[model samples]
Target: MIKEQGLSVQHVCQSMSIGPTAVRRWVEQYDSEQAGQPGIGKPLTPEQQRIRQLEQENRQLRGDVEILKKGVGLLCPRAEMSFRLIDELQTKAIPVSQSCRVLGVSRSGFYEAKRRAAAPVVCKASVHLRAAFVASHQSYGSRRMVAELSNRGIAAGRFKVRRLMRQAGLKPVWKRKFIHTTDSKHDLPIAANVLARQFNPAAPNKAYVSDITYVRTGAGWLYLAVVIDLFSRKVVGWAMAPSMPAKLVCDALHMAVQQRRPGEGLIVHSDRGSQYASAQYQAKLASHGFICSMSRKGNCWDNAVAERFFLNLKMERVWQREYANHAEAKIDIAAYIVGFYNSERLHSVLGNLSPSVYERNMAAKKPIVVSEFT
Candidate 1:
């Protein structure tokens, strides 16, 4: 987790209230960490290091005192935080003198900071909750964030989570303005929109949607075609290439059928793009007994759910990046979908569950509800 976060040893020590030696000892256990990536080596002089430490301490103390003033009904939150840090560091085998200097703490006030008073529950909760928020890649908003906290045995009300998130200046990644990429003007046979915007499937693989989206790479443009199961919104399969073509969608369908093997008459929906409506793409779907459904010409809303998946893919990952080539974009987008989006990213439509988790729970229950999440 530390390697994934890419924080230096000193930051890790501060975040976990451990000493530098303890952090090194613990992180050395990670294969990625022990592999020795090149690290930034701007050596800080003693005075400069002291200044940085003072700034960090100042921020912590300011945050503590501000939280105390926010109707949390705690007195001297900074003092409480100081004592807690001291205790935690000591428990991890760090000397008081060593930690004090690093944290910009004063030795003369050590006894005063150690007052035996009960700390505010809210304050304690925030530390652990903040860690969880960071662990989530700052993707979870308050509702999902509350669920994440609960999973870690940190019980916090949704309102408190919202308030804390606002206070901490954390915000969920947001969707950008829309653009339609469907090319429905071609003179190709288009199937009727049999799916008809009915996005919530009763079970996995019963209904699937495919759409092509593009990312700007330095070389030119990289296009991606994705097949998503409507039941849980999981991207079952995807293919990325330098150009959008029938082969792209065909390859995506092949992978989807290979992985999921949806039974006969499974509805495969897409916009009436030439690629999707072409003989090659339709033949692949027919081979697997997939019932092809196309959105009406000039009507992207008929495939709203597929469009939404593309929106999220761009907003959460693609939009922020400037890829050097098709290969770079392909690798990054694939990792985003498989590594983070499918397995970990929470979806509100899935009742704050990851798509795979929701799918598993649905399989266990096996009940048909129109609103699966509700």
Candidate 2:
């Protein structure tokens, strides 16, 4: 009406029931198309509209080609890797459903992969479990493995750890039968079992248990004595020698005394071995004002904590290798006690904390009482 009847834009808008702005825009677009120039929005002429449609189709085709090329490049023998690539592309603004369709992967599989990727614990737990197993000399079962993982800030249950361990083919060393090393058949007087199966002490340095065990080496036997504090199950002192004499037990006691410096009346329990009954060992205890307590004759269970420690030492470290001499055995056993058992090995009795860790935690919870030796 504006072109044929020479109507004003306002008149045309009124007649067409439209706004004046729309009339003005339509006139301008018509003029632009007639003059073979591009205009914004839908074209006013069929030729321009066809060109716009073709351009849109061309862009769509280009996008399709790009998607197909990427899909081909991302194809892999492993579906998991492909899913990971798809995830990366989705983060880069690629459509997940479209990518999955182009890559011939199910959308459900891609979503599952996304869920697994979001929760990294599943993958990380397996890796950390294997490393911890190896680090513990392959002697950590699922229970200890769970504790170790918890220490590392990974929350995992025993069943989960067990499954991961089984998948990794990890098997811990099993414990063997305990060997008796106590010889109480002597005329020396024996102290009463004052401890009387009181394996758990309420406070540090209150009570201690000592025992001696032999390690086999190419150069013969190497004897090891340990003094364990019942409070934390920590090996407060240890000594290794070629013979199990009064000196061996005494040296171990001396180390314990020097480290702990327990007060007078500290109950020092040990098996009724000949060394414990010897005058030298008894006098050493008497000099420190420490009360001696002997385990009953032929009863390993009476001093079971000390015996268990030796059993663990043999099962985890001693039996695993053949030492050439006492020096080699001493070095290795010392490493097991100080480096691993004291600092890293988890004890069920100590609530899955290593002996050193248990002591440190207890000291943190309360003030330690240091004693002056008499």
Candidate 3:
């Protein structure tokens, strides 16, 4: 082969492992070639060059097919006959069967696509919606997504949003539940229902709702007691402990006392739970010169403010976590209650302002005595 390209006979024998006879035959072919085009190498005819180009193109196409096959195998490894079927369908121009056979997508998948025709796709529009959804921390479910779409002036229904979420494998990270955390089962003398189902407070610190909730953790269960100011809907004081003893509620009350130092007649309402009704708890309230109020037995509505707070806490935070133990739950709950709930969470009744913001607003307003001394 080398001698045919004008190499010396001995060089061909040594370099190419060609025997003497093969080298002599190649030298003979080279002499014939040089006789035709004297010392120039033989050139390929047009057909041979065309064939070479076609062969190169075929090899490149095969390489691409192998890469595509590998990707499809990785994505849907269990399924067989992916790109091969796609290519066959493409060649035959039978997209429907090709989609079903190659993609291993069922007839139903094709029908679904046909029934729900692929909408006019715009890369920019999809990019915007995906960016918005992602920027929301995936906290938005179909309802919120639909609302967002509407806000962005994009026409979309809840079902459509749900379908898109399914396609994108997205879900809302937050959920809701009915929380029944108040254990009003203490033997202590219950206070009068002074709040009287009146949750509205005309001034900050005038009325507060207290409740206790259980958060599971590694150590055990961490009990959280909170006093929410009714006027501002702000959690003034919160305490977390390993149990729901009187001290749990007492610490929370003390926090409120230290923080607000409301006038000598602030009314603090709670259910007839032992934590609140305990003698020690009542004495603490008296020490702060605060009036104690209790909800009637089994009537959660009487302490609705506290109930609502617990509900929101569970819905927004607790429901989303799997507590490993008491300590972990405490840390997460503390962060949620103090870091997010009290300071950042927007309450609809508070005109969508956080409790801190609402309290600041209330403090800005002049207090008007709506209730008079008897």
lDDT of each: 0.78, 0.86, 0.72
lDDT of 3 at 368: 41
TM, every model: 0.63, 0.69, 0.54
Model 1 stretches astray by more than 4 angstroms: 1-120, 135-137, 175-180, 366-374
Q: Is candidate 1 or 2 superior in lDDT? A: 2
Off by over 4 Å in 3: 1-187, 364-374
lDDT of 2: 0.86
Indicate whether candidate 2 or candidate 3 has the larger lDDT.
2
Best of the two (2, 3) by TM-score? 2
Q: List, residue by residue over 254-307, the lDDT tens digit for candidate 2.
A: 999998889998999999999999999999999888899998878889899998
Residue-by-residue lDDT tens digits, candidate 3, 275-371: 7878899998887678999988888799888877776677667776789987788777778777877776556577656688777776667654333
Top lDDT hit: 2
* Order of quality (lDDT): 2, 1, 3
Go through the candidates in order and give the C-alpha RMSD of each one to the true structure: 28.6, 10.7, 19.6
